[model samples]
Target: MTSAPADSVDALIEAEFDKLDLNHDGRLDWADYEILIDRYRKTAGVNEDDRRIQELRAFYQLHWLELLRHSGAAGDSLSRNEFVEATRRTTGDTNRLDAAKVGGHVIFDLVDADGDGSISRDELGRYLQGVWQIDQSDPRYDFDALDTNKDGVISRDEFVTGIQEVLHA
Candidate 1:
């Protein structure tokens, strides 16, 4: 397979960073991520004790810590450049493809609402609409593309592989 252009990978990284920034402040902080988790929980009707909810929270926390560790910043926030650098370090790759894969996995875990190791169309649509603010008209979140196996559901591997393909194309 042909590798994606560097510009494409950079754009994907930037888009993912912008989506997580939430406040349009060009930085990611606890407050922004907290809002994200809370919003998803409320929209998805996930209870506090739900294992998926807990896992989401835990994973987000772990990712944040990893970012901070890589950035070596004293502040609780990560600028876009810092975020990119951290992702690169975390993925241990000079190319951004691995970072995109890691981000895709994180996104898969977040959107898989039922903790069943796959994402239903409903779960993906809800996440797109509620969290990513993408309307149904936006083909970016279409189930056909995400459900790479034509199974009507998106497994974690499918989701990550699909994302990688998109980013690398």
Candidate 2:
């Protein structure tokens, strides 16, 4: 896809860096990343374990490379327009109802454990694993872990909270 102007991408990248640069140092560093992660997970009320933290770091590395290669000049950060485009590609577009419909379908499919038109815990755990690209030779343990009430099915609220917890965690 054709990208935004160089200045545009630079602006976007700077904004992202500012947002992620919690220390307000005008640059991103590992120390800033730790603060970001802790705050993000705390807001989501989730705790990311070490493995997931590593995974997130790897993903960010890939993202940084992509932005730098596509929309950034050497040693140049991304502009806001370019950053928005890049993020949209990674997170899917929010401007279209069709996209939202598809997103819901994905979540719904993940939660339909019995294929009976309703979401259950088993389906939910699998969905989270899939969303996070987690490897599961058998099945996910999220259902067992988050199903505090031990009900046969996890409510919609539980499903959302569980995924958010794991994602930020």
Candidate 3:
């Protein structure tokens, strides 16, 4: 597969950093992660007491720690450049953290509103539109592209693989 150009990848990473820097504070901290986790919880309609929500919290905590560990920053938060570099290392280092697998599982759980094992088109659309505010008109986010088996829904494996591809890319 052809890889994206360095400039394009850097641009994408910068864009992702902007999104994750929720409060526009120019740094990524646990608070940003909490905001993201809360959004996922709201989208899933789960309360803080719910087991799944608790798991999601745990996942984010671990993920945040991993990012910090990889960042090599002196502070608790990561600057934009630090975050971009940390993300690149964390996503590429499967030995230390299988980000795609762990993140994909949690995200899939949140997107599967019906508690089903797979992601339906409607569920994905809702997730894309709600959580990330991604425009549904974007062809790149099409369910058909992710539903490799063409089974009308995206299986856990398919979803994870798609996430892995993006992370690596």
Candidate 4:
């Protein structure tokens, strides 16, 4: 796939970071993430199992921390500039490619809730809701593109490779 221009990619990442900031606070901190998690937990309904909620909480926590660490601001929040810089770093060089691949795997594992080595539409939807604050009414990614084989499920290969393609494109 042809890579997108670096400027475009950077702008895209920046826009995404703005979306995740949630509170219009111009930065993303632990509290902002917690607010999102809480909203999702509530949206999941009281009937949702505690175990599942806990698992999602853990995943979101790690996801938040990982993003912070990538920005080299683990103990603090990230401004848009910091986030965009970190993302740009991951799009360059062999070491960056390796890091990006590992990060992609981590995300795939998180979303594959049943641990069946693939992500179903339902799982992806739920993950988007809980982690990214993306409601069922709004998908965060192109589900069709990620499915790759039109199989209605995203295998680990698809998730990782699709992520790489997205990053470079």
Candidate 5:
């Protein structure tokens, strides 16, 4: 359970801006800015059904508007670092929202690859690969950590509750 970096938001923002400034130009045209935001929506599950980019655009329209308003009349675009900080800060505190945490359900769904309401070690390995970007070949791929009770399977409760202790606080 690695802690999110102290500067996760900053890094996210910076990376986006750097990516948008493809030509190393200080300014971003509409196409350039949209490209960056498009990536964010897809990765964030704003558009997971392969729907049109407009669907993703609608998801971010209000949030981007809010961010712009928060910026107090920005320049050509939100700076790279600012975008990440905004995302991190805007995410609701998981501890405060117990209604199945914003992403906990998504993570659970991801782990339950077969839609079987629970996960086995193999399913977990694939989930970690797809969602958390973990490599199964990594030396630290300890299957036992998630297989609480040593039953050789990861019940939803075990995977969620066990990982939270180290990851949440």
Candidate 6:
């Protein structure tokens, strides 16, 4: 499959970083991650006691640590440029951290609100609306793109593969 251009990849990363930088301080820290976890919790309608919420928190902790470790920044937080570079390296280094696998699983688990091991279009819509805050009216976020098998739901494999493609694209 053809990959996205380097500039496009950078743009994607930047866009993600901007989303994650909750405070708009141009840096990423534990606080930012905590806010992200909270968003997921609220979006999934799971309390902090929920296992899925706990797993999401753990995933964010690990992901944050990995980013900080690879960031090479002097402070505990990562600057915009540091975050972009670290994400590129961390996502690319599957040997150390299979981001698509680990992250995808956690995200899929959270998005699968019915605990049915699959994501229905409605579930995905809730996630997109609550977490990503995407407009439900947008057609570009159609489930068909990720539901490769077209089985009416997004399986774990399909979700993971979609994330992998985006990361590597």
For TM-score, the strongest prediction is 6
Candidate 2 vs candidate 4: the lDDT winner is 4
Instruction: Indicate whether candidate 1 or candidate 2 has the larger lDDT.
Output: 1
Residue-wise C-alpha lDDT for candidate 4, range 1-169, written one tens digit per residue: 6777889888878877876787888988878766765655564553245555565566557656556657887558888888887666645544423544665775665577677999998987887766675665554386777898999999999998987776666
Model 4 local distance difference test score: 0.71
Against the true structure, candidate 6 has what lDDT? Answer: 0.86
Q: Write the per-residue lDDT of candidate 6 for residues 101-143, one digit (tens) a residue.
A: 8989989999999889999989989988888777656764678
Question: Candidates 2 and 6: which is better by TM-score?
Answer: 6
Report the C-alpha lDDT of model 5 over 56-126, residue by residue, as the tens digit.
34444544554454454356365555554444444433333332242344356545656688777777666
Worst 10-residue lDDT window for candidate 4 reads 90-99
Q: Tens digits of per-residue lDDT for model 2 on 49-143?
A: 64444444444555455545544444545444555555444333233222223334434433454557556654554554543333433343455
- Estimate the TM-score of every prediction: 0.76, 0.35, 0.92, 0.65, 0.45, 0.93
**lDDT per residue (tens digit) for residues 1-169 in model 1:** 6877767666766777988888888899988888888877786776788666676677677767777888887899988888877765655542423544666776676687777988998888888888778785677667887776798899988888886676545
Task: Give the Å error, residue 83, model 4.
Answer: 2.7
lDDT of 1: 0.75
Candidate order by TM-score, highest to lowest?
Answer: 6, 3, 1, 4, 5, 2
RMSD of each: 3.8, 13.2, 1.4, 4.7, 7.3, 1.5
Model 5 lDDT-worst window of ten: 94-103
Q: What order do candidates take by lDDT, descending?
A: 6, 3, 1, 4, 5, 2
- Residue pairs in clash, model 3: none
